[model samples]
Target: MGERVLVAHQPAYWPWCGYFSRLLDVDELVLLDHVQFSERGWQHRNTVADRYGRPVRLTVPVRRDFGQRLTEVRIAEPDFRERHWRTLSETYRRAPHFNRFADRLQELYAQSWTHLVDLNEAVTRLILDALDLKVTLVRTSGAPPSGTKTAALVDLCRRHQADVLRVGTGAGAYLDAGLLERAGIRIEVAAYAPTPYGRARSRPAGLSVLDLLMHEGPRARAVLMAGARTAPFTSTPREVHA
Candidate 1:
């Protein structure tokens, strides 16, 4: 009934506050599950803050097939989940709101997950539910379009009937403004500026939304939206979030 806003990104593990911030005002989210797996990216790992204000990275080992899409990658280790849970418990057990979300997170880690993307999606879903963000989800792994870069994104926009594509500056190098305009989809800049919720002052402003949740609990939603905003798209910028 109104102009539709859409955001698309690969699933991330223990996503940061900014990740959920992207969904704050969008109508739909396209999980780019069909994209090639990146070994160095946040798709399978994220950082959390240690009790002593240190940054600790948690990575999930993934077995990537030759030219495998994200959806096809498998988790390489069985004990990673247990280790991660233990690490979280050790790091955040003293956090003010850890008890509020511990049971759900523990239950999540206890489940069996085979695919890397599935685990990331589950983590995303867990955070989405915790934040109470209501947005439609569409995965391209089941039927990915045949193209690379901007063209594929345009196709996804058209396919989903998205009136506008809301993305962060990191996508600018790969995104073609004219192409989106031709497709009748406008590009808007959406991003999260970190508001310190008492974490190490490092590259990733808020270690992870998980950290934010531990510290701020139900107030995280407000903290997340505090720095989140959208504007007309422009130059490429390096992403600084999990």
Candidate 2:
């Protein structure tokens, strides 16, 4: 059988190009939604460039709970959708290809989404479609419960029958390669040198994938897939549970 590669990450709000680069490399991408929600994490927000080329964060307000799982977190204000759409429109309307994707993107914002996971998933899927990435997507909440941290990740690999696990560089800090190796899953850590997009004089490093799509249009996928390197795993421990 061919290698069954899996990439898993938290559902991020309008994630950056690196996220898509990682997704595009794998056979299946898993959304780890059953994990705890971190207010300070990328779960509900992402940065983008404004008209002046300054980085601005577009955040989705959510009802804060002491230990809420991402899947359980509800949107604090649905009205933020209109404001976000307006911001995106105003910020990127002059982008060379903004007109191509604006209407479809605006339609996404028009939907009523009460949960953060639902919103993030919808946005992620839309961007994937735009980029023409065909990887299968699965959610952890729908799968059998994986234990925490490395054990959970290993469980996910086992459940999906993955022969290889692709992860972002940030995950190298916490992911235990030995655990995955024991499970017969080889680890490929992605080294993504940020791909520059947009016509801004000084491009921001980690803006949302939308920045690339709006600015580069049909060529966005090529731009995103460029400059990605993968290496065999090594690691230290850190706080990224997923």
Candidate 3:
């Protein structure tokens, strides 16, 4: 049997290229939806390039509670769907491959999503499908309880039978290496250098996957996997036809 690698992260709204880059190398991905929702975090917003090629943030307005799990957070504004779609249309209509994905994009936005986690997961899945990534996705909300912090992470790995726990470099600050090692899980910190794509004059470093797709089209997945520390699961590229 091949090495079982598990990667887990909060399901970010319209996640950036680096998010997909991390997924490229993993066998399974667990969306940590049981975690507390943060208002200022990427759980409800992400950056994109505007019509003028400047980075702009597109956010989903959510009703907040003092201690709400991400899966429990509700959308504060019902019109967020129309507003976000309009923003994307106005900003990216001129992008090379925008029309290619526009129909499906519009369909996604048209769905009535009441919870923040549902919306984020829907979009994440859409982007993953577009990238042709085949990793199995799991949600922590449905998984067995795994204590808290690093302990929870290690437990998650154990539950999934992961020999290696892959995490982004940022996790180095918070995740205890000794704890994971003691739990019999090897730690691999992903070193991802973003691969530049598209013909935009002003390229932003970490815009959402939408930006990459609209610009690079069929080549977006290749660009995303270019500089990763580990090789992606599949080398056969899927063609994105308009």
Candidate 4:
């Protein structure tokens, strides 16, 4: 098999530290948009504070009545951007450094965007473009044999002709590593270790990539790679969590 990586992650808005951690170590990142949505999760909502420095969520509306699995689910709202902006502005309007990137973030949000898939693809492309990362990004929708859970992920790797499956740290709990090894491919877990950063708030330590970007700018990529570590197999979830 050729050099490649398959990372199956649920689509998250502006993704968090762990997402970028996997991106840095892999050659290709695959979003598992077809997976089930864990409720109260990053799938349909993410946090941005109000002007008061308190957290507020920007939500993607889902069909409350739609009992279909996440693979069958689609973003139901038409006015995603407008609602996102209004909520964000109200929350971050009072934040300490809200003025710094508020306008830019807001402008991007207000653009003529439609479709959750389009929005997800656009933001993913934008963030990668901004970071100048060379990794190939693909969605599960485009991959062959889009199954669910382990079968879906394994099939993606097989379809991509990958010899090694690069999984996020915490995912080991749910993945059958032994099954993968028997299939003649290695399983590796990637970690997003904390990098030194300063923020307007005294609450230091690693946070979302937004915290890194706000504090580090272009240099953020360096921190992302160096601080994001990768390792070979372990069935225990602790090492994965590490």
> Which is the leading candidate under TM-score?
2
Question: Considering TM-score, where higher is better, how would the candidates rank from best to worst?
Answer: 2, 1, 3, 4
- Reference-based lDDT, residue 142, model 3: 79
- What are the runs in model 2 whose C-alpha is more than 4 Å off? 236-242
Best candidate, lDDT-wise? 2
Candidate 3 lDDT, 1-242, residue by residue in tens: 88788888998999988788878756567999999999888999999988777888999999879898998999999899999999999999999999899998999999998998888888988898888888777888876455898899888887889888877756656787788888888876665677767885348787898998999888998987785664322123232111
For model 1, which pairs clash? Answer: none
Q: Which residue runs does candidate 3 get wrong by more than 4 Å?
A: 230-242
Candidate 2 or 1, higher TM-score? 2
lDDT of 3 at 148: 90
Q: What range of 10 consecutive residues in model 3 has the weakest lDDT sum?
A: 233-242
The lDDT values for all models are 0.82, 0.83, 0.82, 0.64
True-structure RMSD, every candidate: 3.0, 3.4, 6.3, 3.6
- 144-165 per-residue lDDT for model 4 (tens digits): 4545566666777788788878
Q: Estimate each model's TM-score.
A: 0.92, 0.93, 0.91, 0.78
Model 2, 1-242: lDDT tens per residue? 68887788899999988788777656578999999999999999999887677898999999999998889999999899999999999998888988899888899999999999999989988988898888777888876455788888888888888888888767767887788788888987775666666665357778888887877899988886675667766665333222
